[model samples]
Structures are given as C-alpha cells and as structure tokens.
Target: MQQKQTPSALDRLKELLARAGFDWFLGALIGMILLAYLWPAPGVQEGPLSLGELANYGVSLIFFFYGLRLSPEKLQAGLSSWRLHLVVQFSTFLLFPLLALPWHALFKGGSNELLWLGTFYLAALPSTVSSSVVMVSIAGGNIPAAIFNASISSLIGIFVTPLWMGLFLSASTEGFDIWQVMGKLVLQVLLPVVLGIVLHRYWGAFAEKHRQKLRYFDQSIILLIVYTSFCESFARNMFRGYSIPDLLLLGLTMICLFFLVYGIIHLISRMLGFKREDRITALFCGSKKSLVHGTVMSKVLFPDANMVGIMLLPIMIYHALQLLAASVIAQSMARKAGVAAEGE
Candidate 1:
C-alpha cells in the first residue's frame, strides 16, 4: 500500500479558507476590481461591445432562470410556516432599514455620506436566495421555509427596495424619477421573471438540470457589472475621497452589522419558541443581502455609472463577511447537531 502523504501547510490554509467560504468567486470579485483599476477603458467603453449593455441583458436572464427554478408547489407547501415567514421578511425589509436609518444624520453633509447611502442601499436590499438556502441546508434548517422566505424576499424586494431608496435617492441622484425606475425594473427584471414562471412547466426542468451552468452565467454577469461599475468610478475618480482607513472601517462596520442582525434574529427566534431548524432558517435567511439585486438594480437606481461602484462597496463587503461568518456558524451547527444525534 502507498504511504499516505502528509498535508502541507499551504494545503491546510487552502482547506481552512474553503471552510470559511473564501472561494474562487470571491477571489474573482477582487480580481475584477483590480482589472477595473488597471484596464478600465474596456469596461467603460460604449457601443456594440459595451460590457454594461451585456450585463444588463444578463441580469434579465438571471432573473428569468430564477423564476424558472421556482416551484409553485414548494412555495405553496412552505406557506404553512406563516410566522417564520413574517419574521424573516420583516427582519430583512424593515429591521435592517430602521437600523441604518438613524445613522444617516451622522453621515449627512460629510465625506462619508456616500458610504452611508451605500450602507443604506445594502440594508434595503433583499435576502440572497442561493447562499441563504445553502447555508440553511448546511445548518440543518427548514429547507422549505428557507426556500420560501428567500424567494418571497426577492419578489418583495423588487418593489420595497425601490420605495426605500426613493426616500433618499431623489435628493442625491440626478434625474431620479421613481416612475421611470419602476418601469425599467418591470421591463428588465419583473417581466423576465414572469415570463420564466409562465414557461416553467416547459423549461423548469431544463433550468434545474443546468443550474450549475446557469450559476456560472449569473456570476459572470455579476463580475461584468462589478467591473463596469468600478471602471466608471475609477475613470471619474469617485474613489479618490476614500482612503484605506475608510475602507477598513466600512469592512468592520459590515461585520458588526451582520452579527447584530444575526444576534437579534436568534433572540427573536428563541422568544417566539422556534425549534432549532426554524431558528437556523430565520438567522441565515434574515441576515443576507442580495449582491445580485444590488448590482443589477444599481444600473437603474443610480443613473451615474460613477456612483455605482461606491454604491456597491458596502454590499460587497457585507456579502463576503456574511458568507464567511455564516459558513462557520452553519458548520458549527451541523457539527453540534451531529454530535447530539450520536449522543442520542
């Protein structure tokens, strides 16, 4: 028999990072930003080969695929968990915005105002679907409820996110027309989703079968959007005001925001007498913000391409931190549940 080779230090570090959710996708996000910094001209160029235009089309397709995979039966079956659904949705749409609202006064008329707006934008967005469900599954949560809440949250966000942003966007964004934004959202996002759902009986299986491929498609589009947005920002010097300390602070704030929401959801779950699985679902589903929606919607929400990159910073940080923190928490929960099972 061949001797088993000892795992090297680099291998151990890679394993640890993987366990913490530092995957290729996250690395690619960083690479896209760097590429934007170095070679932004390609990303910002308009015309037939415009990456921005391609990303817009990709956003519509991403939502269409999302609707395709959504099973009506699963949604209806998951409806029985009304209380859990209420908690998750309210935590996502209401609590988060409220938490971020009070800080606006502090950052108003200051260098960090844009950062605050970006943070509010992050708060107003919906829970991410794929990662939320994945983390919930990893933690042995209520899968049906997780699916239900994540799906419903996305649909709710299509309306509520705009309404939330409207309160501040009108003052800050030039040519900020709510009706126009709504129309664009309907045309680009809602219509595709509706079309996909209507055709689900025919193509749903195809979507589900090739979901892994579709996911790659989704990531590619997101990367394109990120690159283009950052390219515009860099071209216009939108990031000049921000320093390393400012970025470090924003990242720190993102971590705090995640834990604060996570802790609050956990307390609420216990107070409401939730079982372990239900609590897990609430915690994971309620604490996530959709980077997909953030980037895509920024195309419509902030007309100036320059502001889009800054707008995305908080969500990007929050996205990475949530994934890393949630992965660790989920694995710990899984291990605990397994040990309990063995004990029993």
Candidate 2:
C-alpha cells in the first residue's frame, strides 16, 4: 500500500485560514486599499477606460448575473414561510436602523457625525445574499428560504436604502435630490436586474454554471471600487484627521452591533416559536449586511468620492467581522446537529 503523504505546513496554514474565513478575496480587499494609498492617480483618472468607469459598468453586470441566478421557482416556494420572511426583513431594515438612530444625537454637530452617518448607512442596507445563504446552509437552516429572503432584501434595498438616506443626506450633502438619485438607481441598478430576471429562462443555467467566475468578477469590481474610493480619499487627505484608535474603536463598535443584532434576532426567533432551522436562518440572515451593495450604493449616493471611502469603512469592518464570526458559529451548529443526528 502506498504511504499517506503528510500535509505540507503551507497547506495546513491555508486550511486554517480558510476555516477562519480568511480568504484570498478578503486579502485582496486589503491590498486594494493599500494600493490606493500608494498610487491614487490611476484609480482617480477620468476616462472611459479608467478604473472608476470600468467599475461602474461592472456593477450593473454583477447585479444582472445575480438576477440571472435567482430562480423564480425557488422564490415562489420560499414565500410560504411568510412569518419567517417578515422576521428577517423587519430585523434587517427596521431593527438595525432603530438601534443606530438613538446614537445620532451624540455624534451630531461633531467631528464624528460622518462616522455615525456611515453606521446608519450600514444599518439601513440589506442583508448580504451569498454569505447569508452560505452560512444558513452550513448551520442546517432553511436554505430555500434564505435564498428567497436574501434576494428579496437586495431588491428592497435598491429603493429603501436611498429613501432612508434621503432623510439625512439632504441636510449633509449639497445638491442632494432624492428624485434624481432614484432615477439613477433605476437606470444603473434596477433596470439591469429586471433585464437579467427577464432573461433568466434563457441564460440562467449559463450564469449558474459559471457562478464561480461571476463571483470573481463581482469581487474584481468591488476591488476596483475600493481602490478608486480610497484613492480619492487618499489624494484629498480625507483620512488625515482619523487616527488608528478611531479605526479600532469603529471596529469594536461593528462587533458589538453584530452581536446585538444577532442576539435580538435570536430572542425574536425563540419568541416566535421557530424551529432550529428557522432560528438559524433568522440569526444568520438578519444580522448581516451587504458589502457589495454598500460600495456600489456609495458611488451613487455620495457624489463626493472622497467621502465615499470613509462611508464604506463601517460596512467593510462589519463585513469582515460577520464572515469570521458567522463561520465559527455555523460550524459549531453544524457539528452539534451532526452529533444529535448520530445519537438518534
């Protein structure tokens, strides 16, 4: 018999990182920010082929592919769980914003007002589609329901996020017109998504087959957005006032926000008498926010590229925290489920 080969140290390290939810994409995100810090000009260049313009086009394509993958059958099937859907959606849109709203007074008329706005922006955003579903599945949750809720959340956010921002953005941002913002969103985001859904019957399988490639494409666009956003901020020295301690505190705030939202969802799920799968679904889906939507929306919502980078900071921190925390929790839940099954 052939001897089993021992795993190399590098391979073991990679595995450990994967289990910890530290993937190449996350590393690439950090690299993009660093590159923007070092080289801002290229990312901020104004041209058809400029990174910013390319990223704009990529955003539409990303949503188009997303719509293409959304199976109508699954959506319809998942609709029967209306109570669960209500809990998840309400938790995502209502609970989060309410939690953050109380702090608005503390940061208003202060240097940290912008940071508070970013936090509220993160709160107003929708749950992430891919990561929420992945974590739900891992935790033995309602996979189909997770998919439906995530998809629906994205569509709702296209309109709802801007509405929420309109409440405060008009005061803070000059020339902020809600009608114009809605028009741009319809053309750039909603139209493409609708078109893709219309073509789903024809090309859905192709999109699903090459889903991995599409995911990479999505990440690439996100990286481009990050690079350009940070490039503008760096070029303008927008981050000069903020110190490392501020960033650390912001990170801690994000962690606390996640746990608070997660805990509230758990309690609500239990009160509603949800089964194991549904509670898992609500816990994972309700507490998460979409980095993809956050970056893309920032481009449209905040015309000033310099501020866009700062605005994105909260979601970025939260995104990383949710992935790491959810991964560990999901794995633990999965292990426990397996043990219970074995006992049965």
Candidate 3:
C-alpha cells in the first residue's frame, strides 16, 4: 500500500502560500495599477478597451468553489445559536446604514458624490463568509453562529441593498427597479454559489487539488473589478473632489466606526450574559464589513450609477484595516489568555 508523504518544510511553505488570502488581494491591486499605468483603457464617454472586459468566464468558477465548501453540516450547526446570529446580522445590515447618514449629509453637493455614494454602499453590504469564519475560529469564537449569520447575511443583502440604494440615494436613485436588482444578484452571486455547493460532493477532490489556484483566481477577479472600476472613476474624474486631507479624515472616521461598534457589541454581549466563546464570535463577526459583496454587488446593483469606485471606498478601506486591526487585537487577547492559562 502507498502512503502519503508527510509535509516537509518546503511543502509547508507552499501550503502557506496556498492559504495566503486577503494580502494577495492587495498585491492584485498593485498589478492592476501597473496595468492601468502601462496601458490605459478608453472610457465609454471617451472610448473603449481602455479597461478590459476584466473577468471572462472565471467568476463562475469562483462561485463554484464557495458552494463546494459550504458543508451541509455547517449549515445545520450554524443555526443552533440563533441569538448570536441575530446580533451579527443586526450589526451588519442595521447599524452601518444609520451611521452613514450623517456622513452623507456632510458631503452632499460636493464633487465627492462618488465618495459619499461609496459610504452608502458600504452601509448596505453583507457580512463576509470566509474571512469572518476564519477570524472567529482563530479568536476561539462561536463558529456555527458565525457561519450561520454570515451565510444568511449574503442571502438577505440581495433584497436589502437595492432598497437602500433607491431610498437613501434618492437624488440619482430615480427609476431604480428593485426586481431587476434581485435578478442580477440571483444570477451572478446567489445562483452561482448554490450551484457550486450542490456539486461539492462530486467535485470536492478537484476543488481541494486547486484550492490555492482558485484563491488566486478569486483575488485576480476582485483586482480586475477594482481596477476596471477605479479606471472608470479616474476616467470620469470622480476623484477630483477630495484632497489628501479628505483621505486622512476618512481613515479617522473608519477608526471611530470600528471601535464604536466593537464597544457596543461588547456591552451587549455582557448584558446578554453570553459565554466567552459566544462573546468572541459576536465581537469579530459583528464588527466586519464585507468587501466581496460590496465589489460584486456594485457592478450588478448599480449597473448605470456613476462613481462606484469612490462609493465603495469606505468599505474597501474598512475591510483591509479591520483585518489588520482585528488581527492585532485577536493576537493580543490570545497572548493574554495564554498567560492566564499558565497561571491557572
């Protein structure tokens, strides 16, 4: 009988590369920037092919992987902690929108219409699936609850996001058809995922074999989306509104939002008397803002809207920063707990 070889140091290195997630996204961003600089695409207003078609047929494959990974058991288990699920969902779809209102007012009638729109988009985004679950597991959080809430959040955002765009972005949101938006999400996002998940049992081995490559593929699609979107924004001069100082202010605002939500969730968990594990889950999962949903949904939901790149800015910034900051906090907490365990 043949035996599988143990992972050597070199094998471990490759596995780590394969497992490398969000940071590759940042690299993809750099690559797209280079592409833009080397060969600028003409705008629709100006011309065509200035930006490429971006993803050809690769996106379907990305969704397929998502479906393959969502185990039936995880779905069942995630439902057990209904309370935690509620907390995370409310934090995502509820809290962020209310907060963006003031920022919208503050920036109205400005050239930064795109920036303001991006903040609104940020508010309406769904919670993430992979990164949130990964963070929850790392932080010793409630996995089932994280999975349940994150999964449901995606399903719910299909309806809620368009309603938000129409209602809140009332000026240009005229003639927005909610049903059409629903169809786009179902076709592009939800249906693709469902198809992948359904075929998981048969294709599981194939997916595992190319997992790293799939991750790279996913990142590639996102960067293309970002680049094409940003290239459009630049071509339209949507960024003319803000200076470096505005970006500084935007970063500060994001910091405040993160801590405020973190504090509020911490307080609620205490009031509800959740155990440590559940509390950890609540803190990480509830605090996240989804980048994947924001990116994909922007293309579908705002098929005709202008300045989507600037509009998606808050969530994108928040997404990367949140990962870094949460990672630091999670690590610190882990170290502290380790010391306490030693003492005990």
Candidate 4:
C-alpha cells in the first residue's frame, strides 16, 4: 500500500480559511475598507465612472438577477412550511429590533447614539438571501424554505425598514422623508425585481449558468458603495470620534447579538418540533442581516450622507462575523449529519 502524505502548514491554513469563508471576498472587503481610508478620492461620487451612479445601477441589477434566478414553483412549494417561515420573519424583523432597542435606552445620553442608531439599522435590515441559503444548504437544511424566507424577507424589508427608521429619524434628524425614500426604493429596487421575475421564464437558465460570475459582480457593486460611503465619511471626519477600542467593542457586541438570535431560533425550532432540516433553515434565516439592503437603503435613508459610513459600521462588522460563525456551524452540522447517516 502506498503511504499517504501529510498536508503542509500552508495547506492547513488554506483549508481553515476556506472553511471559515475568509477566502470568499472577506479579505477583499477588509482591503476595500482600508483602501477607503488610504486613497478614497477616486471612489467619491464626483469621480469618473461615478461611484454613485454605478452603485445605483448595480443594486438594481443585483436584485434583478436575484429575481431571475428564483423559481416560483420553489417558492410555492416552500410556502407549506408556514410555521418555519413565520418564526424566521418574526426573529428577523421583530426580535432583532426588540433586542437592539434596549441598547439604545441603555446607551441613552451617551456619545454612542450614532453607533446605537447604526445597531438599530442593522437590526431592522432583512436576512441575506445568498449567504443564508448557502449556509442552510451546507448544513443540509431545507434549502427551498431558506430561499423563500430570504427572498421574502428582502421584499418585506423594502417597506418595513424605512418605516422603522422613520419613527426614529424623523424625531432626531431635520429631513427624513418617507415618501422620497419609498419613491427611490420603488423605482430602483422593486421595479427591477419585478422586471426580472417577469423575464425569468426566458433567462432563468442563463442566469443559473452564470451565477458564479454574477456573484462577483454583486460584490463589486457593494465594494464600490462601501468605498464611496467611507470616503465621504472620512472626508467629513465622521470617524474621528471613533477609536480602535470602540470598534473592538462593537464587534464583540455583534457576536453576542448573533449567538443570542441563533440560540433563540434553535430553541424555538425544537419547541415547534421542526425536523433537522427545517430547524437548520429557521436558525440561519432568522439570525442573518443583509448587508446588501443595508447599503442600498442607507443611501436613501440618511440625508446627511457623510454619516452613512458610521451607519454602516455595525452592518459591515456583523456581515463578516456572521459568515465566519455560520460557516463553522454549518460545517460541524454537516459532519454530524454525515456521521449519523453512515451509522444508519
């Protein structure tokens, strides 16, 4: 028999990074943030390629492609799991806000009000579609349900997130217009999505074939938005008051928030007697927040564009942490499921 060779340290590191999702644009995200800090001038809206215009078009395209890929039959089939869907939506829109609201009360009259608002914004956002579906599928979850819940969550958030923000922003800020925000959302987001769904019958297969490349396209748009937002913020010195310790604390808080939701979903799924797959779907779909929606919505919601970077702080942190944590959990669950199946 031939002896098997041991993997080198480099191979081990690569495996670890892959498992944790670090290899999947996480490094690029961090690099984008740093680039924003260093040489952010070109990313500004005034520059060529016009970061703002490109991001606007990109957001529409991203959602259009999303709708194009979704199958109505899959959505209809997943609708049977009403209980699972309710739990996920409730956790996302209700529980997340409830959890974040207290943080505002706790930190009331503090210098971190902006940060608290950012947290609330994070909480109010919907669960991510692609990552949630990917994580659920990896963990052997009910993927159709994941897809349905994630997609619907985005749709619901288009109306709900602004309503939630309006309540607070109206009282605190000078110009918070609900109708203006809704108009933009309808034109840019809803219209494109509807168009894509209508066209899906013609191009669905083509979309599926090119989804890998499309995913990169989606990320590129996000990076552009991030770089632009942070550049504007840096130019205005919005990050001046923030320090390393503040960021570290925010990161820790995000991790705690993630686990709290994850644990709650797990408990609820068990109490409701969900099968393993449904349980996995609920836990993942409930715990996630969409950075895509957060970024897109911030452009409309916050009139003071400079503060957009501060608003996105919680979102960016939570996005990275959730991907890392969810990937690890999914891998572990997959391994155990495999072991059990083999034993059976």
Candidate 5:
C-alpha cells in the first residue's frame, strides 16, 4: 500500500500566510515612508480634505457592516455577562489609559508630545475583530462572546476614542478644534457605518464571497492614509534629530505595553472567576486594538499635528508585532492545553 504523503514546510508556511492576511502592509508602509521621505508634500492645498472625508465614510461603513452582521440576541446575551464585559472594558479603557499616563510622563519631552498622544490613542482604541475572534477560537474561548465583544468594542471605539483624544489633546496640542474633529467623525465614520449596515443586504454576499480579495481593500485604505500622513510628516521634517535608538526604545516601550495589558487582563479574568474559555476571550479581546480606527481618526483628530505621524510610528510597529506575537502565543497555548489533556 502506498503511504500518505506529509505536507512539507512550504505547505505549512502557505497556510500561515493565508490565515494571517499577510500582505504588503509592511512593504507598503515602508514604500510609503520612502515616498514621503523622497517627495515630501506639506504644501498640498487642502480642499475640504475629501480623502479624510472618504475615510470617515469608510470607517463608518466598516462599523456599519459589523453592526449589521452582529446578532442582536447575541449582543443582549453578551451584555448580560456583566462580569465579563467589565473585565474586558476595564482592561481596554481604564487600564491602558492609566499605564499610558506614566509612559507619557516619562517621554513627555521635545517633540514627543505626539508620542504621548499615540500612547493615549492606544489606550483609547477598541479590540480588533478578526484577530480577536481567531485567537478566541484558537484558545477555545467563548466564540460567540468573542464576536460580540470584538464587534461592540469597535463600535464603542468610534465615540470613545475621539472623546478621549478631546480631553487629552486639548491640553497639549495646538490648532485643532476638538468639536470639529468630532463632527468630522460623526459625519464620516458614524454616518457611513450606518449606511453600510443598511446596505449590507445588497453587498453582504459579495463581501462574503470575495472576502479574501476585499481584505486588500482594508489594507489599501490604511496604506493610503499612512502614505499621506507620513508625506505630511516628511514635508514638515518631523523626523529631524531622531535616532535609531529612538526606534529601539519605542519598540521596547510597545512590547512592555502589550505584555502589561495582556497580564493585567489575564489576572483580572482569573480573579473574577472566569472559566477557561471566557478568560481567553478576555485576555485577547481586551488587550488588542484596531488599526482601522487609529489611521482613519488620526487624519481628523490630529490633522494639524505634523508630529502625529511619528506618534503613529510605535503603534504601527506594535500592530505588526502583536499579530506575530499573539499568533505564537495562541499556538503555544493550544499545544500546552493538548499536552495537559494527554498528561491527565
């Protein structure tokens, strides 16, 4: 009898890449940065910033589709899990913000105000959708609750992130009207999301059918925003006096931030008597963030803040690193659980 062939290492690599939605996000980010560095353009005339306006609509539509796909019954049930919700939200809004305060204080010098804003922005963001759900499934978390938590978290972020920025940014940043920013968000993010939810019926099947292809749309929008934002930064010479060590420190800072948030949420989940599954959901969903919201909002929220581009520097790094780190962590957890089961 012929023996069955095992998959080779390349086959395994393909599987990981497909699952991760790996693309030129980093490559695009690098290219965009280089373009910005080469053809810096702060002098571009602003004509109501239609791109930002469009991005606003895109953000809204994203959330709208999420709201559409969300089952109301599931949301109600998830809401009833008050303890779970508390642990998740506390880790997101309160815990991250509190930690950012010290991080901000330590780095609150020179042009690092943008860095502080970025730190606060992370505190303000909501849980990610795809990754959180994936991690929940990998770790055997409550899958339905993960969906509800991640979806609701994004919806909550649109409002909360802007408000949080308003409070913190008002004291330090200049030339930006907080209220105007909020208005832009409501018009762009909120309204479009509502539109998408309403129209999801028409595009739902198509969106689902070509889901892999459409994932590129998501990255395209973010990459465009990154290019534009960095171009502005380059035009304004935001990276002047910055060194390689600064980037290293920023990476270290992000690693610390990620682990600290992850640990705090895990500890609180244990204390609250969460079951194994819910605890996994709590840890993953609570600590993660949305690059979608961050990029879109940065345009409106800190439009005049040229320094904000550098602020996003660490977050962009953290975003990629988190994906890689979380993937490894989830796999390790899965294997350990299996080992324990075998041992028992």
Candidate 6:
C-alpha cells in the first residue's frame, strides 16, 4: 500500500495564513502604502474622477452591501442573549475609551501626540463585524451573539464615535460643528445602509452568493482610501518628522492595547460566569476595533485628508496585530474544544 503524503511546511504556513486572513490582499495593503509614498500625485490631486470622490462613493457602496447581507432573523434571534450583548457593547464603547484616556494623557504633550490621537480614535471606533465573527466561529464561540454584537456595534459607532471625538476636537478647533458632522454621516453612511436593508429583501441572497467577490471589492475600496490619504500626507510632508523608532513604538503600543482590552474582557466574562462559548464571543467581539469604520469615518470626521494618514496609523496597526493575536487564540480554543469533545 502507498503511504499518505504529509503537507509540506510551506503549504502549512499558507494554510494557516489563509485561515487567519493574511492573504495576498495584505500584500496589496502594503503595496498601496508604498504606492502612496512613491507616486503620491494622482491619488492626492483634486479633480473629478479623483481618488477622493471615488473613495467617498466606495464608502457608501461598502455599507450598502453590508446592509444587504445582514440577516434580520439572525439579529432577532440574538436579542435573547441580552447579558452577553450588554457586556460586549459596554466593553467596546465604554471600557475601551476609559482605558485609552491614560494613554492620551501620557502622549498629549509629547512628540507622539498625533499617534496617541490615532490610538484614541481606534478606541472610539466599533468592533469589526466580519473578522470578529469569523474569529468567534473559528474558536467555537456563540456565532449568533457574535454576529448581533458586531453588527450592532457598527451602527452604534456611527453616532458614538463622532460624539466622542467632538468632545476633544471641538474644544481644540474653532468652527468645528459636531452636529454638521453627524448630519454628513447620516447622508453618507446611514442612508446607504438603510437603502441596502430595504433592497436586501430582493438582493440579499444574491449578495450572499457573491460574498467573497464583494469582500474583495470592500478591501479594494479601503486600500484606495488608504492610498489617497497617505498620498495627501506625503505631498504635504506631514510624515517628515517621524523616524523608525517612532513606528516601532506605535506598533508595540497597539499590541499592548489589544492584550489589555482582551484580558479585561476575559476576566469580566469569567466573573459574570459566562459559558465557554459566550465568553469567547464576548472576548473576541468586545476587544476588537473596526478598521473599516475607522477609514471610512475618518474621511467624514476629519476635514483634512493630509492629517488623516497620521490618524489612521494606530487603527491600521491594531487591525494587523489583533488579527494575528486572535488567530492564534482562536486556533488554541478550537483545539481544546476538539480534545474535550473527543474525551467525552
């Protein structure tokens, strides 16, 4: 009899990264950054059909499809888990901001004040829907609750994030109208989502069928936004004063922030006597922040696209770090669950 062949090391690494979503698209993210650094013209220049307008339209379309794919049944079903939902949302909006205040205090008057503001913005954003649910499922968590919490978190952020930022930004800047920003968000983000939900009755299945394609479409739009923002920053020489050590510090800060939130949520879930699956769901959903909301909202929230690149840095760093950390934790949870099931 012929022996079965084992997968090679390269194949194994590819499989791991694929499961964790560190695919070729990640390479494209890096490439977009480099493109902004090198070219920095077409994307930054003002005109019709420019990257600016395209990114704006892309943001609307992203949410439109997101709403189209959301399932009302799943959402309604998830409401019964009120305790879990309350904890996750509170952790996302309240605990995150509370934890970030010290960081702001530490960095506010320092050279890295802009980076600290980016970190604070990351705190104010919502939990990511796709990745949070994906990770919860991988970890054998409560999928329905994860879906509900993540989806609702996005909706909540449309209001809360702007409100949180306005508390600081309005005090610092003249003629900054928080109400005007809220109105713009309603037009740009909320209206499209509402339209998509209305159309979802007819197009929902079609959107689900083409989900993978649509996901790539979403990432492409985000990459375009990143490119445009960075190009503007580079053109304005806004990044000139930064050094390698600064970036390294920012990266470390992001990783620490992720773990701190993760640990706090995990401990609280245990104290509340949540079951394994609910705890896992709460931990994953509660601790994560949405890079999607961060990028799209940045456009509407910050008037200057040039400064937006700096504001986006922490969210981008947190996005990558969370994926990596959560993937490992998720895999470990899966393995343990498998072992327990087999033992039973």
RMSD of each: 2.4, 2.4, 5.4, 2.3, 2.8, 1.6
Tell me, by lDDT, which candidate is best.
1
Deviating ranges (above 4 Å) for candidate 3 = 1-22, 34-38, 42-57
Check candidate 1 and list the clashing pairs. none
Query: How many angstroms is residue 245 displaced in model 5 relative to the true structure, after the best TM-score fit?
Result: 0.3
For model 3 the TM-score comes to: 0.86
The lowest-lDDT stretch of 10 consecutive residues in candidate 6 is: 9-18
lDDT (Cα, 0-100) at 205 in candidate 3: 66
Q: What is the lDDT of residue 246 in candidate 2?
A: 88
| Residue-wise C-alpha lDDT for candidate 4, range 1-344, written one tens digit per residue | 99899887567445644643456577777787789889877666464468877777888888899889877877898898999999999999999999898777777767788999999999999999877887888789999899899989998998899888887888888888888888988888888888888888999999999987997888888888888888888877888877899999999999999999999889999999999999999998999999888988787788887889899999999998898788778878887999999999
Please provide, for model 3 over 123-210, each residue's C-alpha lDDT reduced to its tens digit, 9 standing for 90 to 100: 7788777777776776677778888777778778877887888775455666557777777667877788888778878886688788
Q: Candidate 4: TM-score?
A: 0.93
Model 4: pairs clashing at backbone N, Cα or C within 3 Å: none
- Once superposed on the true structure, which residue ranges of model 4 sit more than 4 Å away at CA? 1-21, 45-49
Candidate 1: clashing residue pairs, number: 0
lDDT (Cα, tens digit) per residue for candidate 1, span 186-256:
99999988888888899999999998899889989999999999999999999887999999999999999
Query: lDDT tens string, model 5, 304-331?
Result: 7476578678668777767766776776
Candidate number that wins on lDDT, 2 or 3: 2
Candidate ordering by lDDT (highest first): 1, 2, 6, 4, 5, 3
| Residue 61 miss distance in model 2 (angstroms) | 1.0
